[model samples]
Target: MRKSDEAGTRPDVVRIWIALGLVIILIIAAAMMLVEADTQRDQQEQVASVISKLSTVRARLEGAINGNLLAITGLIVEISMNPEITQEEFSRYASVILAQKTEIRHVSAARNLVISHIYPLAGNKKALGLDYRQVKKQADAALRARDIGGIFVAGPINLGQGGRGFVARTPIYEFSESGVANQGRFWGLLSVVIDVDKLYGVAGLTSSNQTIEIAIRGQDSSGSDGAVFFGRPALFDSDRALLDVSLPHGSWQLAAA
Candidate 1:
């Protein structure tokens, strides 16, 4: 081969190599795009799963709380009907209630802001004669129940009996001679103590640690404005799915990541 012929062939070889390099680059870019798409899809599916679990948790939590809170209405009715009811009757009624509701720690009746009667009075003996006016932590909730003439749920606060729990209270009014409830005549407060750990267990929040991260705020049913009572506090500050848990008298915030 002559020199001119060899130089022309070298240029042709270089051109072929450049074209092959461009094809390889294109293939790599396409593969990278497919991998990115798969990653995004997986992330989306995980997010959807977490959100579904969050909804279920919220429903279970609200149902357990509201249903248990409603159970104490019978005791409230009994006291309203007979303000002079003795300890024997109170104990009997409360015993029946506690037997049915496993989440309830104890039930008590506060006559004029002072706890007078409690059922299964073994561990809860200290709660007897407890004056709400004297306890700064519990005074507001106790007073609110009376003033509202309706139900008020308080805590995840330290209980007088022991441990942490929620206190559900409603104002009780005596019946008039005509059998009508005397709204103007204040009798006292009827309260039910709900165990927090047990309630969380019933709500499936504790078992969800493996799949989703959850946190609850709005202690005392104060909604999003209140402090976190469950899970990590940082969850509320990050990008999370927020839900409102409706309570007897207020709402709480549930956050999930």
Candidate 2:
């Protein structure tokens, strides 16, 4: 009888241990799952924060570009209205616009794709007669703009005026003749160079205080594919805010990370 009782007690003890072990295992598994869930939530929040910051950058970038573009529009209008528009005379009137929008580093008028007149020529005097046809880098964009017979944006290249920046060139056409055939005769170009470095300041995209990175690429007037003008061009490869920047006769790809 005593052996039987001892045997039963042993079995009971073993069962109790097994039950405790199972409870311990379950607790550990639950804790691990909770930890994983918390980690995932944190990661999601981080992603959200990054996206929000990128959105802000995108908006600011668009505003800066659009605002400056308005200045360019004014230049085109001024030149379009008067074919004989001289740089000096135009500068006297357009200087105020430049002062208002400091992002425009310089405005130049090209006669037959040659730099003829530039506003505030004190620093850019060297570009006075530089022909786009002679400038290898600028020549392609120049010819394209002329062939397109419209405004095109190119560069962030070493400008003839010195330093690196973007040039928005619009081929001027002469409608001097009365006939419809001569109404669209090609004239010259009115271009504005936006300083690449200074553009960050104006666009408020100078710092990377957010998770998402921002970049810009120059594309042909028809599409969003070209060399990077600013930031990591690879950002465009990943998920990003593809902002379109309208130029005179072209556009740019603004990638916000």
Candidate 3:
């Protein structure tokens, strides 16, 4: 009788140990699963925050570009309407634009395809005997488009004589009895060359540690692949610096990290 009782007690003890071991394994697996879930959630939140900040930056940039274009167009129209604009008058107007170092980098006027431009750093020069239409295919196309009231951003063109820059063209127009006529009968194009660095600086993003990049791709040049205008070291090294935004008309993407 005593031996039977002892054997039964031993079997019970072994069963209890087996149950305890199974419970311990289950607890460890559950803990690991919870830790992984938390990590994944944190990563997702970080990505969402990044995307939100980038969108805000994009909106601000677009607004700034539009505002700048509008102001420039207004100035061109004012100049074109003045029948007696002397060199002094022209210089005064150019000075006003030049003063806006953050927005207007250069100002130019073209009459009968003759180009005259002024830069803040280098002062002013007339591209005498040179026809702007002869230089750029897009310029020719824009002239033909007959949308004189419209504004165009053009070029990574070589501004010969130690000059290399981009151009913005705003057509001048006047209303007539016959029809809506281009300012100067489409004889002239008001052109402005913007300093890319100054334009980017207006975003007030210089102090930011976050990655930022701006690209202007025209019908002319495609942007660089891996160049990050502003970014952290990790993003700068990554090939994914460029954003997936669609290029604007006559303009390219401006991205920030």
TM-score of each: 0.81, 0.75, 0.63
Please give, for residues 155-207, the per-residue lDDT of candidate 2 as tens digits.
Answer: 76776556777677777666454545325656677777878677776566776
Descending-TM-score candidate ranking = 1, 2, 3
Residue 243 local lDDT, model 3: 39
Clashing pairs in 2: 151-249, 172-187, 172-188, 173-187, 174-185
The candidate, 1 or 2, that scores higher on lDDT is: 1
The whole-model lDDT of each prediction reads: 0.87, 0.72, 0.55
Ranking by lDDT: 1, 2, 3
Residue-level error in angstroms, candidate 2, position 104? 1.1
Flag regions of model 3 displaced more than 4 Å: 1-29, 83-86, 116-123, 136-149, 155-166, 177-184, 208-251, 254-257
Give residue 131's error in model 1 in angstroms: 1.7
Per-residue lDDT of model 1, residues 136-213, tens digit only: 898999998887778888988886556789989888898767766545468888889899999999998888564788
Which residue ranges in model 1 land beyond 4 Å of their true spot? 1-41, 176-184, 208-210
Q: Single out the weakest 10-residue window by summed lDDT for candidate 1.
A: 176-185
